[model samples]
Target: MNDTREDMANRVFLISGGTSGVGKAIATGLARLGAKVVIISRSADRGQAAVKEISEATGNSRVDWFAADLSLQSSIQEVANIYKRKYDQLHVLINASGAVYFKKELTAEGIDRMFAVNVLSHYLLTNRLLDILQESGPARVITVSGHPRFLKNPVINFDDIQMEYQYSAMRAISQSLFARTLFAFELANRLEGTGVTSNAFHPGRVKSNLGRNAPWYLRVATPLVNAFFKAECGIGVYLASAQEIEYANGMFFDEKKRIIAIHTQFEDGAGNRLWTLCEKLTSD
Candidate 1:
C-alpha cells in the first residue's frame, strides 16, 4: 500500500464519527499514511482524546478534530463553515458517523435522531462541502453503508420517513441505511461530470459502539459481538486512498473491495425524492 500512502500524504481527509469505532479506525489508517486527517466529534474532550490517541498510534501529528453534533443540522453546517475557513483543500470526505436508537427520539431541530445522524448528516455535510471538493478536483466522497446481504429488500418509507407512527429500532436503522446508500448513488448521478466522485461501502462487521444507545442488555452484549468481529477498517482506508478507483462513482463496495450493484428499487427515482426531502428538512 505504499502507493496509496504516497497518494494520501499531503492530502486532506475529513471524517465524521472519527472519534471512535469505524470512523476512528479509518482515521487512524489514513493518518498512518501521512494524510491530514480531520475528524468530527460531538464532544470536544472526546475529540481531543481521539486525536491524541490517533496521533500517538500512527506517529502522525496532522490528525486533528472539529466538534459537531451530527444529530443537529446547524451544528454540521457550523462545522463545515469552520472547516472551510480553516482549510483550503479537501481531497476526501468519509461520512462514517452513525447512530442506533432503540426508542424514537427527535433532535431540537425536530428530526429523527437516527435519520439525522445516519442519513441527513451525510447529505447536508457533503452538500455543504461540494464546492470545495469540486475545486479540489479528482476528490471523493465515501459513505459508510450496511452489509448488502442484510439489506436484501431495501425499501424507504417516504410517507413515514420519520418513523412517527410505529418505531422499531430495526426498521429505523434499516431505512436509514438504505436511504444513505440511495443518497450516495443520487449524489454520484448529480456529480457525474464533476471532478468529485461519490461512493458507499460496508466497513464489514467491525467492532463499534453504535449500540451504545441500546438497552442495557444490548449494551452489555456489544463487546462480545464486537470481539467476534474484525476491528481494522481496511476497506474504508482502501476506498479513501486507492488511486485506481479515483473516478469511481455511485458504487457500493464490500469489505473485500468488490463493487455491489445498487438495488434496482432505488433506480425508481427514490434518490431524487430523498434528496428533495433532505433539502426541505435541512433548509434554513
Candidate 2:
C-alpha cells in the first residue's frame, strides 16, 4: 500500500520515541518516502543509531535524531523551541510516545510520569509546535491511543488523573484513556481553520513494549494477544497515510483502519474541561 499521493517529498515528519517499537517503524517508513524525518528520543546514542538505521534502510540520508526527555515540561519547551529554530516548517508531528506504569513516578517537574509522558508531553509538544504546524499548513498530528475507544476502561475521575490518591491498574488505564480522548478533542477544536489536523489512533495490541512495566499477567498476556492477531508494527503507516481528517478532526481508530467514534468523552465539554485542567497544571 504505497501512498505516493501524499506527496511527502520535501515535508518533515517529527516523531518522539522513535528509537524502538512502533515509533521506529513509522520513523523508518517516513524516511523511505523522501520526507525528512527527525526522531526525538531520550538517549543520544540510541537516537543517532535509529537515524542511522533508518537512513541505511531507506537509502535516504535525510533522517536525523536528537535526544530529549519529553516527560518534563521544561525539556519539552526547550525541544519545541529548538525544532522551531531548526526547521522552517513541520509538515507532520507524530506524538507517538506513551507509557503505562505499575507504580507512580514523577517527572522532574513533579507531575505524574505516566500523565507527563503519555498525555502532557504530547499536549505540550503539539501546542509549542503549533506555530510551525500551522505555518506548514495542512499538517497532521497523529497521536497513538489504544484499541476500541469504547471498549477502553473509561472512567474520567478528574480528581484522580494521576491515580496518586488511590492507585490501581484499572484506574491508571481508565484515566489515560479519558485523557487521550479529551486531548484529541480539544486539540482538534483549537486547530480549527488552521488546517492542522490532530487525531489519535488505536494501534491495536501490537507486539510492542507498551506493557513492559506492568504486572506479570499483563506482560505475559500482551504477546498472546499479538500472536493471536496480526501484529505488524508497520500498521502505523496505515494510520500515517489515512485520509488526514477527511471525515472528522479527532476521530479514533481500531486495528484495521476502522474508525471508532465513542463521542461522549471526546465531546466539546469534556475536551474543554481537560484542556482547562492541563492549562492550570502547566500554567505556561
Please name the candidate that would achieve the greatest lDDT relative to the true structure: 1
Candidate 1 structure quality by residue, lDDT tens digits, 242-273? 88998898999999999888656564888889
- Please list all clashing residue pairs in model 2, or write none if there are none: none
TM-score of each: 0.97, 0.88
Residues 9-52 of candidate 2: C-alpha lDDT, one tens digit per residue: 77888988788766787887777666788989888888988888
Give every collision pair in model 1. none
Model 1 stretches with alpha carbons more than 4 Å out: 1-4
TM-score for predicted model 1 compared with the true structure: 0.97
Q: For model 1, what is the C-alpha lDDT against the true structure? A: 0.91
Q: Which ten residues in a row have the lowest lDDT in candidate 1?
A: 1-10
lDDT of candidates 1 onward, in order: 0.91, 0.76
Which residues of candidate 2, in runs, are more than 4 Å off? 1-6, 149-153, 215-235, 242-248, 265-268
Model 2 error, position 189 (Å): 1.5
